[model samples]
Target chain A: MNFKEALESGKFTVTAEVGPPKGTDITEMLHHIDLLKGKIDAANVTDNQSAVMRINSLSVCKIAMDKGLEPILQMTCRDRNRIGLQSDLLGASILGVHNVLCMTGDHTSAGDHKEAKTVYDIESVQLLNVVNNLNSGKDMMGNELKGPTSFYQGAVVTPEANPVEPQLMKFEKKVNAGANFFQTQAIYDIDKFKGFMDFARKFDVKVLAGFVVLKSAGMANFLNKFVPGITVPQELIDELKEAGKEKALDAGMNICARQIKQLKDEKICDGVHIMAIGMEDKVPEIMERAGLL
Target chain B: MIITKKKDPNNILETVKKYDKFFLIGCSECASLCGTGNEEALQEMTDFLESNGKKVTGQLVPKTGCQTLGTKIELKKDKEACADADAVIVMSCGAGTQSATEIFKDKPVYPSNDSLFLGNMTRFQMFDERCSLCGECVIGKTAGICPLTNCPKGLLVGPCGGMSDGKCEVSPDVPCAWVRIYERQKSLDNLDEMKEVLEPKDWSAGQKPGNLSTRSEKKEEKK
Candidate 1:
């Protein structure tokens, strides 16, 4: 089923992400698409994910479509201006790429190209509005379009944000801006994620808990230090450390599966969006362990 | 009020080296408080220009440098000296510099101070940005603090996860604006309003070269 249909059907949908490579070689990317096609309900194609230059998310979405997998195109405001964004939305609609994930993305400094000029002409909230406007058959300037898009608009939220008030405030804005669903930042603490969902449930939008599998202890520490809004608790880090060098990956997968299973059992959210950066092959295992299969 | 900082003496000198005689305009408002266009500052600049072998034909510390009509009326007394000057140097903000440019269309008008921001003077000569003039005010919702000015990212809804130790992620010394707002709102027992998520800003309202008439110039379209 398509992402919107799956979300509306409320069967605990599963979504994953696929980051397009920096160069023209799509062999490994295609393999990833094939691996994730049937395992997850929909796969998101990231647009130069860490502000790094890569194959366009639209192009990767097209590849995923060719592989018979539904693709959610992740668009960032850090790179494109309003005009570029509008044109890309129209293009995506024409190409039959329906799902969109709007974000104010990682800053340009986090990417490979440090000196690139960042264009935040409009951030995530405004971008969501633009998508809503387009879906309504009207442009940002209030001009009517000959054809309107039927995009399943989505946005990102950080449940574990230190000052959670602002994030909650923005979450409401996203709902007001016509977000159909939310795929959150990587979630480690389920109770905090549930707290975020308590607020989210007030709105008529789906919330998908983000699950990034912890490969090792060092990876968890790195995310805690560098990634904003993401906190890998000391206990989880300690657990991974105790798992020993050889079994850390397996322990990490188990932790991810447990969180997904808890989220599913508790009905805390509509579903989970698995983000296995370079390890797409292991997603089916995660889904199976979580009893999603 | 508009905040401004004076340009470097060497840079101003280099810019006006070709002109020997000049008229200096200073503002008695924000620029004066900022110490860029006060009477003492004008006198100091005049002495420096004279010491550097340049002529200060006349100088006027106008009540408000940005009020073009009032400045034009005030400059009537110094018309002869202003006419004799090769250029005009405005020691106020960019708006004041543009006023000089508007008044003296022929003479090259230059700004001696760089316009910083519209801010609150926290103390004597210490200015802190309080508003970004986004053309829409949400202070009532944000507990009288502007996220646009205080937050480095200017996030309408934030304190992005990057914040740590109650400080902003972008700038360590800066307290997270949203955090400050939350505290204030909590103290005031107004946390209920915090639930209201601010919608996307109507950016067209703050379009560049913003112009408006406070009252009617033409009749209203509808009653």
Candidate 2:
């Protein structure tokens, strides 16, 4: 389905994400998917979350699909050159994984292999254009492909981005380059999210405000400090801080539900990506409180 | 502001499948300026290589590659350009060819383009690599202001508020970057100019040690 139709399904399309383990273990990963299968519309398999190499995102995504779930394949351009990138795009298509998100992978410095060489012949915007080209039966050099790709191309956004104009400019560029839909960084501040939506609405594209489930205020602070372009406000940190050890989990879920409700009630975005991280079980509860159930 | 361009060696020493007698040739013009194939450089390199054992030959060809074709630019093709030198290490930029390969395409070719984006030459032999284009440009939020450009003295952190009487606190000659930014922003019709504060940039990626460029939200790792 075109991303727009899937996004504006109006029933408030709920999606969840699962980051695979850095090691070769699938039991927890499978459990995560099994828990979210019928609870949400689709599950996204993150590619090497934060660029530290993990179990292949595509392989894990295929596993999720095998469990009778629609997996939004997240492909980053970090580890692949142009040849590998296109091959992977075709690889995803051949695997029947039609919903794919394109991203320029995390920097090598942030990953496990700090000294690894980076083959940067293609980055994200170019990656989006590359997929657009592939779908048009052409490669980066404008060479024709064997067949066209009908993959539903998606990109990302950071609502709380610093100097947000560049993000907006990139958002526009991605759309022009054929990004049909976008998933944003988690939203903790309503004003910031609204501002982002205001910017997004100006462009003709589908947006899913991404929700990264915070385990605690510490996690929020970590992202704000270390993670570039992602800032969870102090109020959310305070809310997390108020939750006692035993009840912290409960408070986190409550916060997630509250945010989800606001996102749905305000129609802040076309959809929301529930990134439960390792805690996939709480997703359904968050959804239930948000009234998606 | 390190402005320079690649100077591909003319006789690239391209694909020296096999070799022995090697002349470390040098170009006196662009290569010299770029600190690569100059006579002093080639001489030093040739001396070091000779000290290591192999028979050596060296020549300093000036204006060797001002044109695209032929040896017309060849000021003088001594024996070093022909016989003694097994392969021509055409120290000129990619434009430098034939002189080395004329006698030896069968030899190798190497590049000296050190290709770099052209930049304004600030001084006689020095240049400032202008417009770093940090991805996180505070230009918009800062009222069409560029803390980078306006500050003649190169300060990423905003100018000191205590700039003694409008001049840069850093120096007397340098105008406060903030003062310039304020003026530019005011003209841009953004009254909100100077209202928004600039965030200290994420020096992690932009830091030379990281070697990361200002990319979109998606940071590309060099594969």
Candidate 3:
């Protein structure tokens, strides 16, 4: 099903990501795509995540399409100006890779590459507006596009930003800019995500509460420290610490599953994007435990 | 007019270091873009300097640095900072730079940033220098990356092995110019679009180690 149809289906849809390596070997990607075949409504391909600059996400989308798995591609404005962004939209539409998640992306500073100059021709809100303009067969600079594109464009939100008001304001702007749906930053507290959802429901936009299966206590703490707009409760940290090394992975997965179950049961979001990161192999297992499959 | 901002505390402290009697000159025009002479920026600079070191004698006057028509009137208004002070720092662009230098030839007048270009802010805090009055723009073909301004090595076809993973080898903290070009290509999915490498740039246009300026009338007359 197309992303929007899947959204309208109201089945408590599930989504996950499978990052393609920098090189051409797709064995690991194949394995993960196969694993998620029937489990998720869609699988997202990260585009040079963390600004490391790797193999393109479009190629990975082609591989996922071959594997009979739907793909939601992540596009960042850090690299492309308005022209490239519009052309890529058309190209992705032609490939039937319909779902897209737009992000301003992690700055070059956060990635392994510190000195990369950023392309701010269009920031996130402007990017959202460009997508809207492109869908209508035009580019940002008033040039008409060669063809039109019809794709379900999605953007991200951080539910845990210290001042939730600004995130909400951007959310409103993004929705106005033609973001049909959104996937939030990872949600560790069900109540917080729900409070965000209550605020979200006031708008006419669809939302998917983001969930990342924590790998270890260290990983959880690291995210809280480095990742902006993401905060994990100390209780979850203590839970991971209690599990110890051998069982930590399983415990992290369980906590993630419980969070997903709560989101699904409470019907707070239209879907969920489980960012397994390096833990893609265990995503299906976690989803099954969460009763999503 | 030559201009500079007193944003850096050390510079402000130095400017006002020994001057117990001072005049903080502010320009009402052109220098507004740099915000050096804008009331808030100037007032803040004045307050910070006074609290940190020297006692600043009050006098902030907006100037018409380029137009000599009001030179007498402006001097009457702001001559206090120039005459009574040990040094005079004009907060204006090159016009303000030269004008201040000419007015207070014996005193101190500094040019900040060499008056790079007319720029606008990105997200307010982050500034992006856009126009370089070079009378030439390659944004159409280069996809707006501005190799002239952005590329350190000025390589047309980039990401030479020097790019150890996106970051440039020339400076580890800096991203290789070619890496940015490659990324722009990837995002547009136009990897196969542009013909291989572009010819080396003709540095002839701006290679000089001297001043550069443009006059709108020259182009208007040419047309």
Candidate 4:
């Protein structure tokens, strides 16, 4: 079944993130897609993840579709103006890629090309409205479209953001803007996530808890120090440190699988979105350990 | 007020290398307060120019450099010196620089300062932007805090995912605009307004080369 159908079925829907390569060589990316076949309800093609330039998400989404995998076309407002964004949405619709995840992307300064000009002509909430307009056979300006797109719209949230109230307000705005589902920033603390879910349950949209598989103790420390809105609990870091270098990867997978299991068992959220970063090959193993396979 | 910063001295010298004589103009308003275009700044530029083997014909720090016609009239006393100069250097904002361009149509006009933004002076010579002139104001709904001018991402509804510890991810020193708005609204017991999803901003209202004429409005009123 497609991602929309999977979500509506009330089953635990799983999605994985796949970043396009910087160059044209899609050999490893295709291999990763092949590995994830039938393993996930959908594969999210990141649009220049972290503002670093990469192969466009649209082409990769089309490629994923050709390989019989549902693709979630991630669109960001950092690089494209409103005109470019709307045109790309139309292009994605024509290519049979329906799922679009709206994001107010990481600023261009965070990327490799720090000198690049940013174009935040429209932000995530407005982008969601644009998607809803397109789905309704109209444009953002209220102009009619000859053909309409039926998009499965998605957006992102930060459950662990320090100032959680503003984030919650934006989350509700996204819901009002017609966001069907939300895949949040990587969440490490389950109890804190439970608190966020208690508030999120008021909305009709589905919430997909984000999980980034921890690779090592140092990685957890780095996440805590550098990555915003994500705080790695000290105990989890200690668990990884005790596992040592050789067994850390396994220990990390175990932690991720355990978290996923708890999230599923407690029904804290509708589903989980796994962001393996560069470790796509290990996703099936992680899912198997979580009893998802 | 419009905030401005001076161009590098070396870069300015290089730009005017081909010209032997220059007539400098300064603004006594914002540019003077910014230390980019004032009597002291103009004297410093004159010294720098003469030491670099260039000649300064004349200089003026007008009451308002952007008042094109008034500046043109004020510059009439230096017409001889201006006519002898090869180029005109403006040490003010872009508007002030364009005034020189209009007055000296035959000579090349150069700006020695870059107009940064419309902002307020938080302290002596320290400026912070507070408005973007988006042509539509939503500060009433946001508790008088303008997110469009403050937020780096200009997120309409609320903060983006990058807000951490009430600070913006882009710059840790800068507090998140939405967080400030939320706090202010909460204090005023107007948090309910925060829940209202603001419609998409009409960008056309702030479209490029924005033009207006108060005289036309007055004519319409008279009619």
lDDT of 3 at A104: 66
Which one is best on lDDT?
4
Q: For candidate 3, what is the lDDT?
A: 0.69
Segments of candidate 3 deviating more than 4 angstroms: B1-223
Q: What is the TM-score of chain B alone in each candidate?
A: 0.94, 0.44, 0.62, 0.95
The candidate that wins on TM-score is 4
Per-residue lDDT over B1-223 for candidate 3, one digit per residue giving the tens place of the 0 to 100 score = 2234444667655655655655555676646555666677667756765777665555454656545446536677655545777765555566665666676667765543245455656553345554444335654555566654554433333322223335544456765544465567667976553334343233355554546457698887998
lDDT of 2 by residue, A1-293 (tens): 32346675655777888888878767888888888887788888888876587888788878888898788889876677778888888888888888888876555656688777754445556677788888889876788889888888888876665445434545666787788888877777777788778878888787887777778887888877565556678887888888866677778788888888888888877888887777888888888887888
Query: Ten-residue segment with the worst summed lDDT in candidate 2 chain A?
Result: A161-170
TM-score for each candidate, following the candidate numbering: 0.80, 0.62, 0.61, 0.97
- DockQ pick, better of 2 and 3: 2
TM-score of chain A of each: 0.98, 0.94, 0.95, 0.99
Give each prediction's DockQ, rounded to 2 decimals.
0.26, 0.04, 0.03, 0.75
Model 3 chain B: worst 10 consecutive residues (lDDT sum): B153-162
Q: How do the residues A1-293 of candidate 4 rate in per-residue lDDT, one tens digit apiece?
A: 78999998888989998889999899999999999989989999999999999999999999999998899999999999988999999999999999999999999879999899888888998899999999999998889999999999999999999878888888988999999999999999999999999999999999999999999999999999889899999999999999999999999999999999999998899899999999999999999999999
Q: Write the per-residue lDDT of candidate 1 for residues B6-66, one digit (tens) a residue.
A: 8887899999999999999999999999999999989989998999999999999999899
Which tens-of-lDDT digit does each residue in B38-131 have in candidate 2? Answer: 6766776566546655455646555545343434345245644446666655555554543445534465644444535334566665654445
lDDT of 1 by residue, A1-293 (tens): 67788899998999998989989998999999999997799999999988789999999999899888999999988788788999999999999999999987766767799788777667787889999899999988889999999899999888887767667777787898889999988999988877778888999999999989999999999998867688998999999999998999999999999999999998999999999999999999999999999
Evaluate candidate 3 and give its CAPRI docking class based on DockQ. Answer: incorrect
